[model samples]
Target chain A: MSLISVGEIQAAAQRIRPYVLCTPLIPAPWGDRDRPLFLKPEGLQSVGAFKVRGAFNAIGRLDAATRARGVVAYSSGNHAQAVACAAARFGIVAHIVMPRETPQVKIEATRAHGAEVVLCEPGRREAVAAEVVERTGGVLIPPFDHPDVIAGQGTIGLEIAEDLPEVASVIVPVSGGGLASGIGTAIRALAPAATVFGAEPELAADTAASLAAGHRVDWSIEDRNRTIADGLRSQPSALTFAHLRQVLDGVITVSENEIRDAVREIALRANLVAEPSGAVALAAYRRGATPPGPTVVIVSGGNVELGMLAQILTG
Target chain B: MSLISVGEIQAAAQRIRPYVLCTPLIPAPWGDRDRPLFLKPEGLQSVGAFKVRGAFNAIGRLDAATRARGVVAYSSGNHAQAVACAAARFGIVAHIVMPRETPQVKIEATRAHGAEVVLCEPGRREAVAAEVVERTGGVLIPPFDHPDVIAGQGTIGLEIAEDLPEVASVIVPVSGGGLASGIGTAIRALAPAATVFGAEPELAADTAASLAAGHRVDWSIEDRNRTIADGLRSQPSALTFAHLRQVLDGVITVSENEIRDAVREIALRANLVAEPSGAVALAAYRRGATPPGPTVVIVSGGNVELGMLAQILTG
Candidate 1:
């Protein structure tokens, strides 16, 4: 199997430079004395997630003919919006396959970026996306498994290393593992002294289990859906699992309560909004799951429903 | 009678560049289709407010002999923290006179920055600050009204002009008017076409009343304190009043309900925490108080207490 390399990630950085935002690495006020925590708020991205980086890189690298043929993606959250936004930027047709049970806000946000939305049964998203590609002759932009997508996400690691070379540890939330896989690879290549760890909710800790077992572990969708972190419900793909095994130092799992508290802490202390999934790394850090040093916690996204955020803040 | 000119603001920008953050002008996703709104989040500063600009500028400009003498300031909120943080950076002593009723968090934050805090009665902060200056022989860094402070605040306007040259209007929250005076001077000098407007809480509309009467108008402290925006209780001084009359096009006063709604909107929509006082500019813009244009709303600070932020978000 092919793997994403640092050189490709550097190229991805250059390719998506004009499209994505260079989000600030803010110092969190609540950091411990010895280990200052820096927040990489990817939530500040235009599409409110780091998925935009992978989406833009994957779409931008397509040849002229392939680009004109259009793109299709399967996602129920940030990836859908990222793909839609990136496709809109490239002036290419995009067909997004989202679960019918997806939140109205996510669906609306994806549609707002000028993509045709095709709703499917929760587990049928891939099949639907495949059908769309078969029917429309569109290129499939896999959310995380694709090498180009992983390379794209790795750009964030490049930025972290460039901005804070002394970063001793990086805590990234893992879902399908695109972010962790890419970021881990980049940090390994660019800042070898920095250890990369994956954060996951206990309710959906398939990535942790998979990493520990040294193989991809399948968790029922119903089991994964028990977590409030909707974006992290999916298990890692084979490609992402392979990358994670190589690059990640360990996987840290946080309780749902910890996740909610982290979201609140980020909002209250850092003055930045963090969706539940986006806040997992912070949750892990707050729980003292990571090693001491200048730690970087990736606040992955902020496209949460307002009511949920209000509830978390109030609670 | 000397006024803070744009030249002074430019110089202040250079002086404080090494100290203060060059806050990003983020595009508000909730902006109107016709007139987009941008947020200059000074709350993201190290001190969690734009007060750092003035503090750093005023203190940094001191001669080595004077700097060695230390600095003194009177504030119960962001300014105290700003002064403390700036003084700490310069490795000079900071004497901050705060109201006895100041929150423990603010007091602790100020102390954490190595400032010596002296608590006094609510209305006696100035008197206590004067006593501290006399005792310590430290230079007083007045919260507002001083030329250096105004020049420091104007750096925000210079940044705005540089970032968005086509910016048509700037809406700034008016407290003692240092921020508005500085920003207005910079915008008028740099981006001549951009109109400057001050946002005030209707409950503490001293600046609005003063501007309307074409002179300084005093409001009782009790009357100004009625607003939820605690930082906006002080009336503008003669220096700030003169600058407001010359530089501000108009003042927009927002109701308490509007201010609350604005705080919520900024948190939910923009993913940025904004104190009630800091959110008044966005509140005014949302209420259509300003003329239609590409508006820049200064989110003055994010130094709000967590409990209060929770209440606002939930309510």
Candidate 2:
């Protein structure tokens, strides 16, 4: 895939202007050891994650006829909720399929946003989503693959460049590689001097393996499910893999412990709530990856369980 | 004291442009109820509170000669740190007198910014700060007084109006009344339709009393200061009182239970580590303040103890 250009990113910004927030690029806490940390607070985005951008962009582009039939998506939380929310905004129905173990908070929130949620066994989410889409004649919205979704996600990078063009490095935590790929594509073109690194939890290092091996790789969910960074569990999609190939400088992995510590560090030092996945990038930066100078860390999401939050903070 | 005008606030926004962040106004999570709750997020300001606006606005106006004598202040934490940090930016010597019980984290953070730290008994904070000013010929930087401080705080109201002019009600947590007075003044001027309610902890309801009695009321600092909302314990200053009398629509007291619950609500729903004082305004809104339609809560600060945060979240 050709890398996303600055012009494209600027266009994405314009397209997403009505639906997205120009999320602030805030300086990290003053007590940091190295150069300044500019946090791209994606947590402040609509639906409380960067996923909304992609969700809205995709849903917005659907033909009126298609929107009338609604859309279907499968994910544990962020993407599932984002598409559901975007559908509601456009007055379209959303069918979200999630695993049975999906958190009650996420399921209820997704349902409340006008999504008809279908729960399935861990291994059957995609099958369940496909069945629903087939039965209902609904279009399936892949969490990360579609071009509109990628463009929507790329808008986050546009905001970053507009907000802090002088950023030295853009560190983004990776899961299905959707966010990292989209942001990296934009940064490579808009802020050429800024290096982009994809961060992954050590427990869920499929993206790192793919980067190392130069091919798409799949790691079983159970194999990478040890980390509390729930959002980092997915292996990269083929589309994201292609984009990462062109734009990302490298992939870095942080331990589950590092991710947890970084989450606490964000709460204590930066005074922000960072979910485990969101903290991976900052964790890699703090542990001294591609460093020194103006670092931009994408704080990916803020959807955390109350029990987990207490656990993270108290411990 | 004359109320700070909307026009003046616009000017202050320009004046302090180089010094502080026009902190992001973050929207609460989608499940965050009928009236959308947008936070002014004073927590993200340069000094981690809205105090920086007042501190820098005051410090910015000092004559060159007076600036050389440096700035002196007294507080338990946030304002002391704010003054110290702001003074550092202008190359001014900051002499901060804090209570002996002031956390070492704050004391070190202030001193790390090159401010002189003087620790005194809790009751002697004001006297020690006065003595330091008198002996050193340093200008006393009142934590929440003077025209510039009010003007600085008034900038928040200006931003609020600009960000959400149609907002129907604003809930501001009041301490010494600097923030409430300035925000109220600006809100009334710029967004005349918005109702500005002062939120206070019932345990430290001095501002509520002062507003009712038409004078500053001294609330005992030693009287069961067990409420997690530590920052709202101060009595209202005369300058703040003068502004509050002219601007605030009403004052509401939140119980200790409500304050903790509010803090938790912000953490869970808003995904922000709002300090107890910061959560008070939201507490008022959530605990039934039927002022108007759309409500904007000024989440005042993010300085919080990790243990306290854990306790709040667990409950």
Candidate 3:
């Protein structure tokens, strides 16, 4: 297992500076008096997620020979769009394997980025992606497990440290754990005094259970799929689990109602559009799961369908 | 009538730098094929509106003795919150005169910022504000007519020119013409090659009609109030009209449906929440009013009521 270093994250920042946006750290209006909260709205990224940072960094690190061979990725959401967009920028061919049940908006967004969309049956995304890589001789870019991807995501933590050196705590939404692992690692190196907390939905709380048990834990796909945070269904890989254990102080699990309320809070108070997965960190913070201080909540993504957002907002 | 100059705008930017946010310009995902659109989301500002820029600059320009006397302002929406927030930052007393029928949310937000909210009859807000200023001996910071206010708002254009020197056109929402006048003046001075256009709802197209007739046109309050964009009901002041005539190339009037569509589009495509008034520029741009080039649209504010936003999003 290769552990990522702060130097690698710093290098990744420099490499992907031109490709990714340095998303603004917006002050949350309803922050507690004792702990002023700021939102790192990665939803404002070009691909509408932090996945762009990792995608660009991983693709940019490829040698000339590998770059010519192109890339293959599997994602039902933001990662697909990120890989497709980053590949387009490099003028490399990309094959994105997505589940056939994925939202039309996500599928269309991926295709719009000039990637060949290969729809596979549910739970066959990984197999389809492997096949594409084998047949096309393309480099496979896993969403959250690789060193380059983790380093790319760490760039966000680097930015937070640079922008707010006095940051006391950082709350990040955890899925396969690339975002939390990268951010936590960067914060550990750059702002060691600041604690890092991972936020997971109660319905898909494998990370919390795993962290508590001191090992990798697996939840059935049906069980993980119960949360409205569709992007956070994947279990953490061994590499990401190792990074999380080293960097995170603890994990916070939020209910479905908490996530819904957080989405509304972000839209109303922060004037930001956040998908359910993107708002989990804020949900955890609102629940007082983290210690008080100058806190930063990472709004992970904003690829929500219109109908779903409307229903949540109205409901 | 003193018109705002680029130098004054530059000075205002410095004065309010500590109080106001230098908002980021986000690239719009659904921009035209020929003209790429960027959104300057002032909604992300501390007060969730560009009004904070003018309010801060106006109050900051006051002498120490005058600042000690505190400030008074009249507004039914964003401006009230702006004055209150800026006053709190400056540690000065704020007396906000709002309409009796003002939304409870706006009223609460103003009070929450530590301002004394004085409610008055809808059309008598100015009279109530004048009385408050007379009684408390507070300096009056009118929303848009004052030179200091216009100069402060002009800072947006300065930032736009600095960030996107290749910008060819600017689309600004025209409510009382303050935003348009200020932005137009700055763009005219800083980026002379760029053309400035004002966007207004067809129901309240007083600015468009005024510009076409070469004078400030009057629209009855009832007629103007028929539009969903409540912030745009006010007609342009004589001072603002003079500036608009000198700076604006044209005005675009959009339908009510178009404004609603723009609100949804900003939320769905750009992943940013925008009020109906703030979304007029994009609505006009969508209607093909601006020429093909790199265009910047000022998303003036994002203080939309949650229920209204839900209706717009769902509808």
Question: Model 1 over residues A200-305: C-alpha lDDT tens digits?
Answer: 9999999888877878889999999999999999888889988999999999999999999999888766778788999999999987756778999999998887
For model 1, the TM-score of its B chain against the native B chain is 0.98
Model 3 docking category: medium
TM-scores, all candidates, are: 0.93, 0.96, 0.98
Name the top lDDT candidate: 3
Error of 3 at A242 (Å): 1.1
Kindly indicate the candidate among 1 and 2 with the higher TM-score: 2
Order of quality (TM-score): 3, 2, 1
* 1 versus 3: better lDDT goes to: 3
DockQ of 2: 0.67
| Pairs clashing within candidate 1 | B154-B182
lDDT for each candidate structure: 0.89, 0.82, 0.92
| Pairwise TM-score winner, candidates 2 and 3 | 3
Model 3 clash pairs are: none
The residue pairs in collision within model 2 are none
Off by over 4 Å in 2: A1-8, A29-34, B29-34, B224-226
Say which candidate scores most in DockQ.
Answer: 3
**Candidates arranged by lDDT, highest first:** 3, 1, 2
| Model 2: number of backbone collisions | 0
Q: How much does each candidate deviate from the true structure in C-alpha RMSD?
A: 2.4, 1.8, 1.2
> Candidate 3's error at A238, in angstroms?
1.1
